[model samples]
Target: MDPGCHKLYHVHGFDSRQFLEHYLSDKADMVFGEESLKFPIENLTKVFTEGHIKGDVLIDLSLSSMVHHLYSACEFFNHIIVLKAQDRCILELKRWLNTRTGAFDWGHATKLHADIEGKCDQLQDKEEKVRSAVQHVMRCNLEQENMTDPIVLPPADCIISTWILGAISKDQDEYIRYLRKFSGLLKPGGHLIIIEDLDGTYYTVGNERHHYLTCDEDFLRKALVGEGFVINYCKVQKRTNMSDLVDYSSSIFIAAHREKSV
Candidate 1:
């Protein structure tokens, strides 16, 4: 398996199917149900089912929950493709998988596992920090993009991104440019799945602030349509969190190809 791909599995905690199931359910609740917003759970279920039947690639971008589901239900696809910004997320995932022997001392391994489990206990705890880490790394990647044309990693048949495009760049124009580059990474006719926090709000990690754009459903739908992606299904859900520091209103988008070109 590719090291990067393996790392994503490990960081997302795919040690067992039961764990993945619980994680997805909790994520669905936090982002959709709790905030009184609707999510495309059924659409996601359909995509997974189709991918399973056709043995196609599921390209997951930043959406750890869907990736977790796909990895747990291994029989659904030929292989998984994960696009992640942080090396630490990958490393943590690999540690969770325990793929390398002698990589960690027994005591250290025990502690690491406990830490991962504790973080996974709630969606907000895991998501806030993980996304912050991804954002920091993505900022680096965006800066690198200025020096050279963006590099397209291996392609996939179905692409899923959550909280990804809205966080592209601090500047709106730069964000659009970055997203266009991201769109170019997908193969023609491939699927695109997105979930984002709609309202402009802040999520804190140990007292640090991570700013977000006000990505309402209309703005995103219009943006994707303008980008030439057909709307297969779109749902705006309220994402609620128990924490006072975190924003509770968010939206989820699940879109597919409208034509054969990017």
Candidate 2:
């Protein structure tokens, strides 16, 4: 692993397909299957079902081409906008949305969502829902003050970010700074749902190691509060499986509402 590759979010270096295969494949273990996939899917389903996180526009800032996190969200938010820092990721997502050949299959994830939602027979329907709801897949630059510059986005009713922050931020302060940028995208009192790898320093993709921030519950709570978010629900699951591909102790899911600007 090159020391320089572990410093910042290198847009072109990530292998989206390999990432899916290693961490979210059909044979994924407890860490990726349960912590990464099931935790967010189940919690987001519950939050949306509770009728409090109402939203029309939702922006997703997940890493790579992963769409498993959006299965439940598509049911709640009418329009979904996926923002990615890498063009490769955007292209990958577009391939799936356009039903192009060589696109990654999300059937397993869709089935999981159907099973959790108690509508097991609607597996194909759930997949279609996600495809239909996603209106745009735009490239983003997290280094820029306005990540989606030159194409200003409407204030989103909700923002769901997963794993991107940890990969983008090199330190805790940088994490809080990037998080503030996330807060700026939400409407006042709008919801912000974040799912992150907790206390992780690095994860590998096709032999390339990527940086991950090592943040704990206290730092995360303080960071959210400092950014004017009132956390409504938070859950953390300890890593149940060990792997050299990734080094993370736990995963965290937090549902918060941005404070109304006074």
Candidate 3:
């Protein structure tokens, strides 16, 4: 199985951000019986806007598909490190960073973000802000003891991995192990943001079908607590048939700080 084949929910290359906007962030279909429920990206914007933590040295443990959610984070962080297991993913991200002729379309995502933050007129400006914040795109292996070995790096103020552990982890045991390893990359009291696919065993990016480690909030919460994390905020977005193409049922987004109890 090609390990890098896993995608951001159902996105392979950039297209419409509709999957993100309507299904993930929209209230009509996304909210069940909660108090104005929002998706991970939307919640993340609120988190950043609340002025909680400025992840100055943010480490993106896995570069999933798009950096739409990290746009707000760029406004707070000085440096961003994006890591992917495959060379193609790294190169594709580099192509976008360097502004190559055919970079994947991220305009749709930026427009959505602008609407969320009420900054509609500054879409282009926000895009550049994200571009400038991302400083490194490195290759990494999630299986290794130290994912980014031989490349000495500073302890991250925050680490963000969206829908990656499920795609790469062999099973629940390995998922817990990976969580422990990721925690070491952060400083004490640092933040860890993880967005996962709930109750998803498979997702199709094209004609090919890729498998993921199916998990839910209970399992994930246990894993995080096992790794010495305190949950701050968690949002679960129930999937609507809006993106009926993808097999995922719900998207889980968690933001926890690593301020372990004594």
Candidate 4:
């Protein structure tokens, strides 16, 4: 969902159900396998129940809308892991979370070390440069397979990747590979929530044509189940403007516990 809808649905005094219904009706093309009208009710209900924020640690992959939702609804967690392809998103989240008034100080210490590596030419010291080069090479090699460089992190209780897997890769195999990588990040019995673009969206954003890997609820459910995750809850809805100038429809995924664990 877009930031506007996040504020609309989650903020005080707005009739969430009414807004969702109107939003869904306006973007019928994106609703998966059902009428747009029913989708709002179904999605809202699941968001209330399954998306209920409860966990010591939370990981948000997209680092935008999902992070906004998680932060707005819940305030406390032992640790929160946010994964993003772009450094700007990560930095923005860190800044936003820190400004919140409470014991929850989203400070730099709260940010777990990232998986990114720097280039050899960027480092002045020879020894440091060599190490950086090696790490950079290793990360590049992993990226080819849609895998993330492994990093030691605090134990997490919840994992959220919203509009990330689909938004990052257009290749189906690559998309699935990234999904598997995300699943591997979670501990046994940890919750995994994902929101993605359902329709094959090809929209323009700042002179770039952003493409999405078209996927349905069944495809995602099957993939997650095959990867040892049990479908606690799932929904495919037409979300409000996922982009700024590019108003395209999208879908959401909310799953939990990799079977027999949680």
Predicted structure with the largest TM-score when compared to the true one: 2
lDDT tens digits by residue: candidate 1, 1-262: 1122122221222322222222233443332233321234344445555543233555555632233323212334455555555444445444434336532222322222224334334443333232322221121143454312364355556656666555444545655665666676566766666767776554433333444455567767777777788877666655545555446365575666636454
lDDT of 3 by residue, 1-262 (tens): 3335554322343222332332233354543212112365587797778887686799886534457768888988999989777666676667778888876666756777788889999998998998899998887766677677888778999888876788667578978877888788888999999988787766544344555777889999999987889999888877755443446677788889987732
By lDDT, is 3 or 4 better? 3
Candidate 3, superposed: residue stretches over 4 Å from native: 1-38, 242-245
In model 2, the clashing pairs are none
Residue-level lDDT for 128 in candidate 1: 28
- In model 1, which range of ten residues has the least summed lDDT? 1-10
Global fold similarity of model 2 (TM-score)? 0.94
Q: List candidate 2 segments past 4 Å from native.
A: 1-7, 10-12, 28-31
Q: Per-residue lDDT tens digits of candidate 4, residues 194-254?
A: 6666765443323334445666777787778777887777665566433343344555656
| Candidate 1 residue spans exceeding 4 A from truth | 1-43, 50-55, 63-75, 99-152, 240-242, 258-262
| Structural RMSD, model 2 | 2.0
Q: What is the TM-score of each candidate against the true structure?
A: 0.61, 0.94, 0.83, 0.57
Residue 203 CA error for candidate 2 (Å)? 0.2
Candidate 1 vs candidate 2: which has greater lDDT?
2
Clashes of each: 5, 0, 0, 1
Ranking by lDDT: 2, 3, 1, 4
Clashing pairs in 1: 10-93, 11-93, 37-237, 37-238, 38-237
